[model samples]
Target chain A: MLVLKPMMQKTSAKYFFLMPGVLWILAFTLFPLVYSLYLSFTDFRLGKEPQFVGTKNYVEILGLDGEGGDDKALETATFSLFLTLGSTSMTLIMGTLIAWVFNHDLPMLRQMRAIITMPLFAAPIALGFLGVVIFNETNGPLNNILQGLGFERIQWIIDPWGARFAVLITDTWQWTPFVFIVVLAAMQSIPEDLYESARLDTRSNWILFRRITFPLIAPALGTVALLRLVETIKILDIPISLTGGGPGAATQTYSYYVYQIGLRGSFQLGDASALSYLVVIIAIIISSIYFWRVRARFD
Target chain B: MDAASSLSSSIQTTHSKPGYLPGTSRIGRYLLIGLAFFFTFLAISPFLFALTTSFKTQTDSIDGTVIPFIQYQPTLINWEQEFGLGGTETFKSLRNSALIALGSTLIATILGTLAGYGLGRFKYGIGNRNLVSWFMSQRFLPPIASVIPFVLLFRDLKLIDTLPGMVIINATFTLPFAVLIMRDFFADFPQELIEAALVDGAGHFQTFRDIALPLATPALVASVIICFSFAWNEYLFASVLATKEWKPYPMLVAGSDSVRGIMFGFVTTRMLIAVTVPVFLSLLVQRYIVRGLTFGAVKG
Candidate 1:
C-alpha cells in the first residue's frame, strides 16, 4: 500500500484534485469527529476546569448518569427513537407515493419532480422553523383546519406527539421527493417486459402490484429508507426549530442532545462530544447495514 | 394527472388487453388519482399556506383561522412589510442571504471545476474506489455530525456568523457534488480532443482551458445551478455557522428561534424571498436534471 506504482507516480495533476478533497475532509471532517470521540470520554464541560474523567461523560450521558446528574441519555433515547421512527416512516411512505405519481409519463413531469424536491433543497432550519410558526397551536394554520373540520382546535406545540408529528409531516413533505426521485429512476430502468409478464399472469392491479411493482422497487425503496434513516437520525435543526425537543424532550433527538450539551444551552463540550460520538457510531452502523445489503445485491 | 393516466391506460390496453376486469382497472385508476391528489396537496400545502399567510394581516395571523379554498380574506399587509414598503425586518434578511449564497456558490464552482478536470483526465490506482466513494458519502454524511464540529472550528477561527464563513462551509459540500458532476462530463469526452491539443503544442492547462472547458459548457451550467441552489437553500450548516446579522437567506426563515405566531406580512415576504432564487434556478436548469442524474454511475 505504501509503494507508489509507476502509474500512480505519473499522476501529479490528478493527485492535486483528489488530495485537496481528502485533506479538506480530513481536517474539517475526519479529524474533528475523531477529536470529538476522544473528548466524549473526558470530563470536559466548559468552565469546569477540565479533567480526564474517563468514561464518566459517556456513562452519565448514557443513563447511568449518577444521582443529581441530568439523566440526559435516558431523556434523549426515547425522544430520538420517536423522532427517528416518525420521520423515517412518514418520508418513506410519502416518498413512494410521490414517486409513483411522478413516474407516469407526462409533459412537465420533470418540472413537477423538481418542484417536489424543492422542500429538501430549502434549508431545514429555515423552512422547518417557519413551518413551526405556520403550525402554531393558537394561531397555527393547522388548528384552523382542525377547527373547520367540525372539531376543536387542539394544542400543537404544547403536546410532544403533536409537535413530533408536525416535524414528521414537514420532513416528509420535504424529503419524500428525494426517495421519489431515486425510486422513479429505478422504476424507469426496470424492464417493461417484467411488468408485461406480470400482466400475463393476472389482470388484477393488486396482483400486478404485489407480484411485480413492489418486489421490483424493493431495492430502491430499501435504499431510500436506509438513506432517510441515516439522514433523519442526524436531524438537529428541524426538531430544535419546531419544538426545541420540547413539551419536555418529546422531540429532542439524540443529535439535538449533542447541540444542547455542546453549544447552546449547557456548553458541556466534553459531554456533547461524547453524545455526538455515540450518535456517529450509530450512524456508521446503520450505514454499514445499508452498504452490506447493497453489496449482497451486487454479489 | 388523471387525464394522463387515463390516456396511458388506453395505450396499455392497446398494447395488450390484460385479463383483468374493467371495473377493477377503473377503481385502480381512481385510487391512484386519489393518492396522487393527496400527495400533491401535501407537497404544495406548505407553499400554499405560506403564500396565503404572507398576505394575512397581523390580526388575521394571530387569529390563525384562515380556511382553505373557501372562506377567509387574503391580505397583502404582510407582503408589504416584508418588502419594506410596510417597513419591517424582511428586506435586511433577504439581502444578507443573497450576498452569502452568491458569494459561496461562485467560489465553490471555480474550485470544483478544476478538481473535476483533474479527476477526469488523470488516472490513479491506489485508494481510487475508496476516495471516490468517500466523496459521494460526504454528500450524504448527515449534517448533524459536522454542524457542532464546524461551530467550534469556526468560532475558534473567528469566522462565525459571517458571509465568508458561510461561503467556506457551503463550498466544501458543494465541492464534492461539483467535482462528481463535472468529472463525469469530462470522462465522456474523447481523449482524441485532448491529444490533438497536445500535438498542437498546447500545454496541459491550456488544452484544458481552451478545448475541454468550452465542451463542458452544459455540464458547467448544470453543476453551477445545482451548487448555487444547494448553497441558496442550505439551512442546517448556515443556521449553526451564521447568526441573523450575517444570516444566509434560508436561515432567516427557518431559524430555530422564531417567536411563535409573530409577523404575518413579514413571514410571507421572507418565504417568497427564500424560495425565489432556488425555484428560478431550478426552472432554468430543469431541462438538464435528468441527464445530470446519470453522473452517479457514469464518469467522464
Candidate 2:
C-alpha cells in the first residue's frame, strides 16, 4: 500500500487546496483592510488625488485638533455605546427568561419556537420598514392600542427620546429571538442528571437555576453577548430606516455616522476611515475582556 | 444492559422528583406555556401586521384600525402593484438580489469546502488552528472600514454596479462563515472511512471526491443555505457597491421609503417578497444556524 501510494506530498497538496481561498482573502479582505488603514492617514476624498495628511483626520475626529473637535463624532460614539449596552443587556435578559419558559415540554412547542425566531430571519432593512409602520404615532397599531386603552397617544417617531425608544424596541425585537434560540439550545444541552440531583436537594426552581443552570449556561451566554455586542455597534439599517438618524442626530450610531461621512454626505473618505478604525479599536477592547474572562473554561 | 439500567434509573429518578408534585407544578407549567405563547405572539405580531397590511389597499392600511380584513375589506391592489406588469423595477431588483445571492453562495461554498477539507484533514508545520483563526478574524473587521476601499477598488476594476462584483464582495464576506462550518463538519466526521478509501489506493482528490464529498451532504446544504441568507440579507455592500443597474431588494425597499413616502402597502409588499425565501429557508435549517452563526464554536 505504501509503495502504491501517490508521490504527491500531502503538505504541499494541502497548500494547493488552500491557495484559492487564501488568495481570495488576501486580495479582498486583507488588502482592503490595509488599504483602508493607509487611506485613514491620507486626504483621500472621493474623486481627488490623495495626499498624506499625517494624522490630521484622526486628530480632528478625536477632538484633539486646536479647533474645538468633532462633537458629532463623539456624540455618535456615545450613542453607539449606549445602544450596544442597552440592546445587548435587554436581549440577554429577555432571551434567557423566555428560554427558561420555553425549556418546558408543552403543546405546540415546536411551532411556537419557530414563530418566535421568525424575526431573526427577516432582513434588518425590512424590519426597519416594519418598525416605521408599527411605531407610527398616528395610525400605527401601538398608539392605536394605547388610545384604545384610554391613554394619551405618545408621539413615537417625532419626539427625540421617543425616536430612540422606537429604535431600541425594534432592535430588541429583531435580536432577542437570536439570544433566545442560542440560550434555549444551551439550556437543553445541560445534563438531566444535574437537574435531577438539584431537584432532589431543593424544590425551589430559583435555587436550582442559580446553582446548576446559570453556571452551566454562562459560557454560552457570554458567547452570545459578545457576538451581540459586536453586531449592535455596527447597527445601521434599523436606525437609518427608522428615523434617518432622527429629528436630530439622536439615533446616529457610529457606523451610521461613518456612512453619512463617507458615502452619503461630505464624502470625507479619510475621516470616515479614521472613525472606523476607532470603532474597530473599541470592539477589540471589549471583545478582549470577554475572551479573557471566558478563556479559562475553554482551556 | 448497563446502559438500559441507567436509562431506567434516570427515568425513575426524574419521575420521583418533588418538583413534579401534583397540581402545583401542573399550574406552573400552564403558566409557563401561557407566557411562551404571549412572547411568541409579540415576536410575530409586527410581521403579521405587515402581512395583513400588505393585503390592504393604501387607504385601508392607514385606516387606524388594528384589525385587518374586518375593519376594512382587504384588497389585492398592493400585491398587484408588486407583481403586476408595471412592477418592472421591483421585479428587476428581486432578480438582481437572487442572482447575486445565488452566485456568491455557490462560489463561497466551493472555495470554502476545499479549504475546509484541507484544514480539517491535513497536518502541517503551520497547523490548521492558526489558519482557521486568521480566517475568522476577517469577520471582526467592521464593514464601514472596508466599504470605501471596496468602492474604490471596484471602480478601478470597473466592476461597480455589476452582479459579478456584488457576488465577489458577498462571497468574501460569507467565506469565513462557510469555511468554519464546513471545517468543523469535516473534523467531526469519522476518520476510518477516509483511511479505508486510502487503503484502496485512492489519491487525496479521489478520496475527497468519492468518499468525503458524498458523506458531507448535510453540511453542504447547511453551508449553502447559510451563505445564501447572508448574501441575501446583505445591505451595506449592496447599497454602496451597486447602483441602479444592480440595486438589490433591500435597496429597493429602502428606496421606497424615501421615494414613495410611507406607501405602507407597497413597502410591506416589497418587504414580504424580499424576506419570504430567506425566512423559509432559515426555518428549514434552524437547527444548523447556531453552528453557522457562531463559526462552529458552539453546536446547536
Candidate 3:
C-alpha cells in the first residue's frame, strides 16, 4: 500500500509537468484542426455560424461554374501534385549538391559557405523580388551583363517557363542549405571506425559512401526531405510577394490561389477551407509515406 | 529564411577529404573551383550592387554603370537614412525591428526555456514523444497553409496588426525548434547528477532551476539567437499582422525592396539595415551556434 501510494503521487506529479503542453496543443492545434474540418462542410464566412450545409458547399466548389466540382478538384490537384513534385525534387537535389559542394576543404570555402547559405536567411519575398530586380527586362544586371557579353537577355520572370524556373531556382537556393545542414550532420555522425575499417581494405570513397555513409545518413536525409516537401508545397510568401499570381496566373501555386480566393477579394470561406483540407490531405499522404519510411528506418 | 550561418563551416569540413577518385583530377578540380567561384559571385553580386548603389548618388544608382567594383562616387547618406541616422522612415522601421526582435526574443526565450526544461528533464513517461513529435511537425508545416486560418483566428482574437500577435505566432513557430534544441542539450547532461540532486531533497523545480538551467546556459543562448533571427526576418505573418503603427522591420525591407529599380544607392542602403540584424547576431555567437546547431541535429 505504501509503494502504491508513493507511485501514485510520483505519477500525478509527472502529469503536472506535461499538462500545459498537452493542453496548449489540444486547444490550439487539435481544436483548430477539427474546427477547420467542421467548417469545411459549411457555408461559413468569417463572421457566419458555419451553417451545416452538408457536402453541398464542397460540391459547389468542386463544381464551380457548373463544371462539376470533381473536375475542378482533379484539375487543381494535378497542378498542385506536379508543383509539389517539382519543388520537392529540386530542393532535395540542390540541397544534396550544396551539401557536397560545401563539404570541400578550400581556404575560401568557409567564408564562401556563409555567403552561399545567406540566401536562406533573406526573406523569400526579398529573394524572389531580387530575382526580378536582377532578372527583369530593364537595367537588371543579368540582362545588362548578357547583352554586354554579346548575348540576348532572357525573360527570366516574365514568361511562364521563365517564372517557373525563377521559382525553382530561388527555392532551391534558399532551401538547399537546410538539406546541407541535416545531411552533413548525419554524415558526421556515422561511426569513424566503420570508415577506418573500410580504408584498411583500401575502399574507395565512393564504395565507402555506398556501403557505409549512405545507409547511415539515410534517416536524416529522409526527415529533411519530408520536412522540405511539406514546407515547399504550402509556401506562399515568395510566390505571392514576387509573382502575386500574375502574368495570367502562370506562377500561381495552390496557396496563392487560396489567398486570392480567401483574403484578397470576396470571401469564399467554404471553398477556401475545403481547399486547405485538400492541401492537408495531400500533405498527409506524401508525408505519411516518408513518415512510414522514417519509422521503418528507426525500427 | 531561418538559415543560420554558423552552420556553413561544418558541412564544408566533411567535403574536404584529400584522397579522391579517378575523376577528381586537375581538370575536375579546376572545374569545381570555377563553379564555386561562379556561384559565389552569383550569390554575392546582388548584395555588392546593392552596397554600391546605396553609396551612389540617388541619381547615379539608376544611371551609372556597374564597373569592375569602382564606378560610382560613394556617400554615407543612404546608410544614414537607412539606420535612421538620417531621421526618416528608416529610423521608424529600424526601431520597430529592434523592438519586435527584442520583445519576441524575450518572450520566446522565457517560454521556450521553461518548456524546454519541463519537456527535457522531467519526463513522467506519459506523453513525451507524442508531444515532441507534434511540436516538431509544426516546424515543417507550411506557415502559408496555417496563415489563412490563423488570420481568421487572429482577427477574431483582435491580434491582427499588433506586436503581441506577431510575437505569439513567432514564439509558437519557434517553440518546437527551442524544445528540440533544449531537449538535446538536456539529454547530453549526466543523468546521475539530476538523480543525485533528487536524492538530496531538491524538488523538481528546484533541481531544474539550480542545476539544469545554469548548466544549460549555452543552449539557452543558442536558442535565443535562433528565436531572435526568426522573429527578425519573419515576413508573412508580420506583413499580415502589422497594419500601420505596429509594422515590424522585415515588412519595411519588403516595401523598400520594390522602391529601388536598379537604383543601387537606395536599395543597398535599405538592405544594410535589414541585413545587419542577422549578420551581426551570427558573427556574435558563431562558436556557440555551430556547436548548438550540430548538437541539436545529430543528437537525440
**Whose DockQ is greatest here?**
2
Could you give the candidate ranking by DockQ, starting with the highest?
Answer: 2, 3, 1
Each model's DockQ?
0.33, 0.51, 0.34
Per-residue lDDT tens digits of candidate 2, residues B84-177?
Answer: 9888988888899999999999999999999888778776466576677667767766788889989889989999999889999999999988
Per-chain TM-score of candidate 3, chain B: 0.78
Interface RMSD of each: 5.3, 4.2, 4.3
Report lDDT (Cα) of residue B214, candidate 1.
Answer: 90
**Reference-based lDDT, residue B98, model 1:** 73
What TM-score quantifies how close candidate 2 is to the native fold?
0.93
A1-299, model 1: which lDDT tens digit per residue? 44565335336656655666667667766766776666767776666755778888766654465555456666776677776787778777767666665555444454455556566556666566667667777777777788889898767778767777877777777777666767666666666677666666777756766776688778767767777787777777677666768888887877777676677777778777777777677777786666555432111
Query: Which candidate, 1 or 2, would have the higher TM-score against the true structure?
Result: 2
Candidate 2 per-residue lDDT, tens place, A1-299, comes to 66533545565677877878889999999888889889899988888988999999988877686787889998888888889999999999999999888877777765787678778878898888888988888888898889889999978899988988888889999899889988887887786777776667889888978988899889889889888998898899899888889879998888999999999967888888888888878777765655555333221
Candidates 1 and 3 compared by TM-score, better number = 3
lDDT of 3 at B189: 72
lDDT string for model 3 (A1-299, tens) is 95586466556655565555556556556666676777678887756667887777666666754866654445445545566677777767766665555444445765665565555556666565555555666666777888889998878767877776666666776676556656654565555567676878854757867787678767777666666677777766666555555566766777777666666677767667777777777677765665455332111
> lDDT of candidate 2?
0.82
True contacts kept of each: 0.28, 0.55, 0.19
